[model samples]
Structures are given as C-alpha cells and as structure tokens.
Target: MDSHNTLSARAVPMDTSNVQIPIITVWVVMTALAAVTVCLRFYTRHSVIHILGVEDWLILIAMVFSAGACVGSIRQTFFGLGRHIWTLSPEIMVQNGIEQFYNFLFHTMSLSFTKLSIIFLYLRIMSHGVQRIATYVLLSIVMACNVWVLIYQFIQCIPLKALWDPSVPGTCFPLAANIAAAVLHIVTDFIIFLFPIPTLLTLRIPKKQKIGLVLVFSLSFFVCLISIIRMVVLKNLDLTDVTYSLAASSYWSAVEINLAVICACLTTLKPLLARLFPKLLGTSMASGESSRPNPLPRKLQLEAPSSRGRPSRRECWRLVQVCVLPPRVR
Candidate 1:
C-alpha cells in the first residue's frame, strides 16, 4: 500500500471509533419473516404434535431475525448527520468502509452459522445411513470454523483500536484467519445444500413428491450463493477507498442477512405456505376428498359467508366441525 503519504496515512490517533447500515429494507424483510413463522403455527400436522414438529423452523427464524436486530442497533449508533456522514472526505471514507465491512462480516457470518444448523436439521430428517453420518461430520466442522471466524471478526485487532484507527498501537494477523474461515464456511454451505439431494432423490415417495422435496431443498442453494457473493465483496471491500461508507456496506450486508432470513423461512414453507395460501399447503381441518395425505391438508372448507370474500369466524368453526367428523350417513 501507500504507507507514508499524508493522504493515505491514518489521521485519528487511538480514537478507534464506535461502529454503524441499510436499516429499513432489512427490518421489513425481518418482520415478514416473523409474521410467517407465527401464521404457520396454526397449520399444524397432528395439531398438538405439529406445534412441536416445526420447532426447528421457529429456531432458525429467530436466529436470523435476531441477527438483523443486531445490525439494526448499529444504525442507532452510527446516525447523527455527522455520524452517518462521518469524515466524508475521500481518505476517511476508505477507513469507514473497512469498519462497516467487519461489522457486516460479523453479522452475516453469525447468520450463516445459524442457518447451517437449521439445514443440518433438515439433513437429519432426510438422510439415512452414510449421508446422515457425513452431514453430522460436515456440520461439526462448519460450527468450529464459524466460531473461529466470528471471534477473529471483532477481536482480531490488538488493543482493538487498530480496528478503525491505524494510528493505534497494536498488531494482528486477521487476513489468514478471516480468509480461512470464510473459505470453509462457504464450502460447508454448498456441501450441506448438495448432500441432501442424492438422498432425497432416492426416497420411495412418488415422483411429484420427490420433485417437490428437491425444489424446496434447493432454495438453500440461493442462501449458499449469497454467502459466496458476500465473501467476494468482503475480500475486495477490505481494499475499497470508502470501505466504511454505510451505503456500500449496508446494502450488501442487508442482502446477506435478508437472504439468510429468507432461506430459513423457505425451508419452513410447508407451514407458512399453508397459512398464506391454504389451497397449496392444505388445511388441518378441511372437509373432503382432495387431501394430499401429506399430514396437514388445507382447511379451505367454507363455513360462514363473506362480504368482501374472506372468511368469518362462523365459517372457520363450521370448517373445523366438518374435519372433526365427516357428514356421512350410510
């Protein structure tokens, strides 16, 4: 780099600053993620057991939404007009960009780690002999490396002041640690996503069901892609002139966390889709022959009337009664 030049030199001495990102888009998606989780609960399997059944879904959803909340606090810390535009000068923007990068880094890596746990949960459900064992081994490695990366993320700088202000007296070797952790984390994401497919492909279920499982699980691939992309952005981001600029860091960081939330919600689609579009996910207490036999069939039987075309409480009660006992007299 440009070591001794004034323009390129560190200006702030030992004042390594407090940190800061896109607050709104991230919140909106996170809210939707929470709403879906709540709605899905009513779409139970064995009703009581169904609530217990989707526990993993609930945990994954919480992990992602909570991570967004962490980044959300940064906005509070980083936002006086002076704070947001802190040192708008070009050289200082470079430093700001680096700081944001690490903030985003910690947040997204935490998210990736949590989502992998959920994905492994799915792997356990779907895998058999060898695949199941392999998945467990892979996930162990993922958790270990991710923990290492997270520690390195915020703690790598000595005296910690070297994080935002190079003028601070300290030392660190974050490059190797960061790069190794990222590489392993990315690899684990892809592997978790892939390992399930072959096992899913071999299930004794019908063709349509098999295809549905494949498609649904493949959504995790999108999450994997986002992590990989973030990895690249972060690597180059460390070099950018405006590395701490909120816009640059916030935009992609939001993408990364939002994507994690989206993936968590997707895996749980069996429940959420049932809530939003009951016709597709099938109802718990519906009356009739069109049941998919896949546990929670849609509860779309009309009971009461609607003025604007939605159901009334009476309608819901009648539908429940019908499922409770078929109206057959033989």
Candidate 2:
C-alpha cells in the first residue's frame, strides 16, 4: 500500500491539449518576416542598385541561419516544448534534448552572422578614419567572442553524447556559463547600437535627412531591448521546469534574431523606396543616379569673376570645401 502511494505521488497528470501553439505561432511569424525582408534586400541590392557588396552577402548568410533557428524552434514545439517536462514521454524528451543542442547552435550562428552583417555594412558606408578603425576593432572582438561561444557550446558536455543522453556519465558546463554568455551578448549589442551615433551626427546632410537616418539607425535599440529581455529570461531559467522556462527564452531569441535581420535590411531599402515612392522618401534620385555628379557643385562653380564682382577668399575657400566633400545621399 505504501509502494502504491509512492508511485501515485510520482505520477504527473497529462495535458493532452496543445500547449505549443504560441511557440509555433511566433516561429511562423518570425520566419515570414525574415523571408520578406531578405527578398526585398536582394532585390534592392542586385536588381535595383546593380551593386551587390560584402554586407549584402553577410546578411544573406545570416538569414539562412535565422531560418535554421526558426526551424529548430518549430521542431522543439513538437517535442513537448511549452508543456510541463513531467508530461513528456521518454522518446519526446530525448528528441527534445537533441533538438535543444542544435537549437543553440542555430541561434549562436544566426546572431554571429547578423553582427557581422552590421559590421560589414558600417565598414562599407563609413568614411575611412577613426570610425572605420573602431568598426574593424569591434568586428574582431565580435568574431572572436562568437567563435568562442560556438566552440564552447558544442563541447560543453563531455563525451558529446552526454548532451542528449542523460544516462551517459559525463560532466557538463555549469548553467552560469550560459548566463555569462547572455550577458556578453547584451553588452555587445548595446555597443553595436551606439557605435554609429557620433559619426551620424557629423554628416553634412540636411537636418530632416539626419533625423530620419538617426531614427532608422536607432532601430537597433529595439534589438538591444530584446537582448536584455532574453538575458532576464536566462537568469530565471529553471532546470527542473525547463520546458516551461525555456519558452520565454525561445520566443525572445526568435524575435531578436529575425528583428536583427530586418533592421540590417532596412537601411539598404532606401534606394528601392526612392525609386518606387520618391515622394514618400522625399528624394527623386533613382538608384542609377548615385554615380552622377550633384548639381549643388555646379551651382558653386565660380570661375574667377570680374575684379569688382569676385567673391571674398574665405567664401571661395568655403565653396571649394563644399565641392571637395562627397555628395550626400538623398
């Protein structure tokens, strides 16, 4: 009778209804956004601009990894994710373990590539000086940190198989390692979000254009917010209630990565928008007109005027400086 009581006490009631619906929904929405943004970026870079550069390629690769991460999340949902761990069958649990390992890999790769994409975009657009040097330094740091995290992720559990098979006798890294990683990610995201601000403010563009660019670049602040939320979720991660606790992290990770991809693509869409809806973007310059000389320089074209009408030397120097500076993007 005592034994029967013990067995009954250990048993958990099953929840037959689907608890993973929300996870699936989030994944579906994220994947769709990533797809749409990637398509638009490709069209703008290759067909519209006729200049496909390194940043475009990096973003494309990041999108691929983002898709992989989305697929992993969807697979996790089918294996008792979003439900109580006690309700999972042994087979589902095993599958979940395997899927979780791959999910981390997908997440790390996606995030690394996204950062690289942003860095490459900065390198391409920024003038060669302290800003460019700073970008290169950040790129190196991001690459090293991401690679270390990826390597650590795969080797965190000894015997390798111990990652998926709890029966194996092997050591695993402490959960603190994961928390530390989350903190690092959030820190780097904050840095990346703020890195371009000083240079952006120094541009010679009109005030309206400057404000618009600032707002556009400031979209990374949302990504930083998402990273902070992910870090909070990681801090409260419950090993015993992993399936439930991990749902928050999974959702935030999906949103963060896909949103990063979307943000990276947003800046590249200006040319396309300028072509399709010039009035909306407040620019009539077609994508192909990027190479043409600006009419502003011609207006400043002042050959040596008659002695009486000649401008002051200071005014002539100012005009020369304006002519030497690169044309602003409309």
For all predicted structures, in order, the TM-scores are: 0.63, 0.82
Q: How many residue pairs in model 2 have overlapping backbones?
A: 0
| Residue 268, model 2, lDDT | 75
Point to the candidate with the largest TM-score.
2
**Quality of model 1 by C-alpha lDDT:** 0.51
What lDDT does candidate 1 reach at residue 151?
Answer: 72
Q: Encode model 2's per-residue lDDT on 1-330: one tens digit a residue.
A: 999988886795555455578888897899789889989988876675455668778888888888888888888988877888877887888888899889888888888888898888777656647777899999999988898888888888898778778888999988888888877777888888898888778856556656877898899999999988998888888889788778888889889989988988887776566557655554312344453333322133333545666644333432222222223311
Best by lDDT: 2
Candidate 1 has a TM-score of 0.63
Residue 29, candidate 1: how far off, in angstroms?
3.6
Off by over 4 Å in 2: 1-18, 284-330
